[model samples]
Target: MSTAHNAFPSQSATGAERGALRGALRGARAYWEMQKRCAIIAGSVNVLMLVVFHIAGLDALALFSVGSIAAYALAWLCLQRRHNRLAIGLMCAETVTHAGFGFLLAGPESGSHYYLLLFFPALFLGSSPRRAMLPAAAVLAAYVALDAWVYAFGPMALISPFDQALMRHFNSAIIIGMLSYLAIYYRKRVVSSERQLRAWAGSDPLTGLANRRHMDATIRALDADRRGGELAVLMADIDHFKSINDRFGHEGGDMVLRRVAEVIQGCVRDTDHVARWGGEEFLIILSATPLHQAAETAERIRRAVERIAFDELSCEGAPLRVTLTLGVAERAGQEALQATIRKADEYLYAGKHGGRNRVCRHADDPGRRALRQG
Candidate 1:
């Protein structure tokens, strides 16, 4: 195998890794925005709670509220400074502090334990699932230890039944609100993830064109709903592709492929389907297009590719030019789509052998027709 061929897989893997990293960074930024919003809302709520507790003459509750507000303010500052790790750390610390202090102030019966439940979802929302695992485990351990300690040591202060009932109701409301926010956030994340996965599955990783599998699926769907309209397929291959790779190296070969795909897409109608068939080959499915128009489109694509300025792609500063060979075939009514593809492939090779830079049509080639008749 050539060095380029041997290197292509590794290059593709590296590209995928880069793409994944980009996606992860995007997800992290989105999560940070959500966390920031949550923090601001929670901070505002804490301020209101502080005022209420102060008016009600509940000194202990007011003190806890002040601490919560300070923690949220620091978290916000860290987030604004783009210190996401620090922000996450502070948020976790604040959650643990709330759980520990709330338990010491009011104990289990006053719903102080509900504050501990927020830690897991908060950690999960602030960071990726993989990264959040350790923090979440630690939070769980702290929650358990604090609960055990609180139960063993007893409630730090005795309060009236009315105050205890009010605290329980307030804590319950907060927990329920946070849970609802998490549910909506989780649903949105799931939907966004599914869309990204579908796009990755259907598209060519390098050129961003439709992949062969997606093309096959498109052809099958079109065949099922022909509506008696003419459907044409143009199979195009890069001429002297191996030579291009040999001269330009794999990176340059990739650049040429991407440029060729752009040229092909530019030549076709928006309604038409274009796919990177495999390697240097591309397939265009033109629905409601006659055989003649498909050939014309193929010619346009060939001319566009020929016009690509390859000087910038060359390491040696020598100008380079590339050409395309295409085969045009029209689907006969009720005929299998694979048969049409096969005929197009046959014509494509015919052009490759006849002269490597031209479009071939089955109806225009008498020799191919005569051979079939024979």
Candidate 2:
């Protein structure tokens, strides 16, 4: 591996942090699955309870109304653990159910007021913050209205048992809001850690470019139609790069390489990608640009590197400069990824043989006019 200094931010975490993140990512998947199965079971139980309560009739409505919350809670718990897009079904159904339940125990003394406490956890388990807050707030607003219209004040104030329960219900909503905030923060951390691990798996330690393994994956992604742009590839090698290590030491050579990689990345578009292709060679992919355009782009990178002065780069020694030779090609006619790569490789070698530090598009083609440009 080259000892180049990369500009990419380092994401190495403490041992405990790394282990915790991996465990969380893996565990979350299983938890979601478990929650989903449990939800189905809970839904079944709730259906049974609702049926029994409905059959009994009369004031049974007040007693059985809480069952709606219970049933919906199960569904929310199940969805919170997975990628189910319809998780909001839980919120929608639950909210409407709560509103119906609210209107049912209309007495100034109805218990429907306290039932609102359940909304907090429901909100916590709800599919999204907005979904959670809306229902909870609506229920709170309903209570505010009920508080003014309840009968405990006897025809003057219509306060009922349900309306009286509003304070406790609102408290529960606050708790759910707190818990949801914490959960969201935890999720953000989990996602950030996973992103770091992904970067480590695919990036070069020295240059921050995609490692060869990642390049392979990128090629697959390109062919799978994952990327929308036309595919162009480049293979580049440093000109007489080894001599720097021979003259100043490997550390100095490393500094030079890091600088070159930066220059290359800077010259490329955000849509384009570059990877360390092992040793002193690099691979680049330019998106949305065709072959002839790719050649021009590659040359632009070449010229950018040609301008970097490495002699000032120092580590217990004078600085150094680096130059590169690049081979350019496109997937215009080739259907297979390997064929496209081979074509670029052929040109890469051609650039090497034609003279170091010049960009070459193809064999028999007039290449860079600069005198070895390095």
Candidate 3:
């Protein structure tokens, strides 16, 4: 449990709010994953630079590179442990070390000042915007002081002309490469966020099924396409749901709803769509299915729901049983979706009044009456 839980409550008031939170978390996690990737890449690059500097006979640079490697390694370890703040601190230390080395090697004259640009992306990636501000300011101030010192007094070690030119090119290359990576990573994150936002807008948070809005949109789309054979709609209501909630708390009610959703989804075909219409009620849209077949599917769902013991969810040792009444209706000619749903709803009410745990379809009404008489 964390802030995510508070933002994404188990019992959300509206589907839109729940969907928005899910989308936000998806976007946030993607950015976090990118930051972790950046840390690993930075660590590997530091190790490679350490070896290169060591071979080039640059003692001071090599020693600083060794410290940089250690700092990045520790940062990486912290990330593995899920200690993001510690990893950010280590990355800051690594940045400072890199600046110090820049001063010791060739200072401002060799374009070592360009290395400061690296801190911007690294700091932003590793920390939140509010938290990154202070560290970014401090790093910038330190780099400015170092640059002023180098300009006023000159570099400590007098490196050869060839080494100065090489250092300048190398530092420039690193900055360009890092900038390229940041641009691509940010772009990809934006795209992913947009996609998740769309999905959340259409999805129900509790059961991960299509929300009412999405279902409506889908039905409208299907209705527009008249080429389809036939469509059947089933309206299902859990029986004695309030009593279940009364006996077992709201948490238990939530669990039962989720279980019912799963059972209905498992009973339906892949082409069929299931949605949580509202509290304790679900709607199923079966493509190319007639009323009779849809009734069979509803019966299957009813049986599956009845079989659920809900042992884990029960407060007492006794097992809990839940039942549902389903009504099936098929779309006729160019009939409106809402009209068909109304027909289904009428049948569902009839079944609920007659007896719970039964499937009622237009064709089965007479047979049910005869059976009752017999």
Which candidate gets the maximum TM-score versus the true structure?
1
Cα lDDT tens digits, model 2, 1-374, are 12332222332233335556766666565445534643554445445434433443323443544566575565666486653545546644554564445434344333335545545664554346876787788877876676665534333323444444552353245445544554564587569667877777777766678878888998887888834657788888888766676776656666776788898899898888898886677888888778889888888888898888766555357445567888888776436666777778777767766766777776564433232343
Better of 1 and 2 by lDDT: 1
Which regions of candidate 1 fall more than 4 Å away from where they truly are?
1-12, 23-34, 122-158, 314-318, 363-374
**Position 336, candidate 1: lDDT:** 80
Clashes of each: 0, 22, 0
> What lDDT, from 0 to 1, does candidate 1 have?
0.79
Candidate 2: deviation at residue 42, Å? 33
On lDDT, the candidate that comes out on top is 1
> Is candidate 2 or 3 superior in lDDT?
3
TM-score of candidate 3 against the unseen true structure: 0.81
Return the lDDT, model 3, position 238: 88
lDDT of each: 0.79, 0.63, 0.77
Q: Could you arrange the candidates by lDDT from highest to lowest?
A: 1, 3, 2
lDDT of 3 by residue, 20-117 (tens): 67777766677667667767777676676666556555677777777777777787788788898898777766767676766656666566567678
